[model samples]
Target: MDFYTVLSRYYDLVFQKNKKALSMIKHLVEIDDHTSLLDLGAGTGEEAIDLAFEGYHVIAADLNED
Candidate 1:
């Protein structure tokens, strides 16, 4: 199965799935104005977009596909 294709659908699901934990972490990282996130092997960009919406400068990296 093409993992990226499958992952794309569940991308937002992950965030919503872990909403409570993420909210806790966000409170932990309650620091300065400029924050950054690196979504390694970022699949359909859902996580990266979410981080950006939360005021993080996201660096989404992934391998190219056909």
Candidate 2:
């Protein structure tokens, strides 16, 4: 298996605190339905998923496929 594949299995655990950070960022930024986000180097797509849930169109790009 590749490194990213193994890392993906535990990415959430490693970045559990990122949810709070993302929330803070959301509060600091004003995003509307028309806003589209490009999450470069997105790993495991956690942030992208959260942003999408918040109604923003998110494009998550990463070189690794896990």
Question: RMSD of candidate 1 to the true fold?
Answer: 3.7
Give the 10-residue window scoring lowest on summed lDDT in candidate 1: 13-22
Candidate 2, residue 9: Cα displacement in angstroms equals: 2.9
What would the per-residue lDDT of candidate 1 be over residues 1-66, giving only the tens digit for each residue? Answer: 687666666665664544564577577765356776676766556556766777777788877341
Clashing pairs in 2: none
- Residue 20 deviation, candidate 2, in Å? 4.2
Q: What is the number of backbone collisions in each predicted candidate, taken in the order shown?
A: 0, 0
Segments in model 2 whose C-alpha atoms lie over 4 Å from true places? none
Candidate 2 vs. true structure, TM-score: 0.71
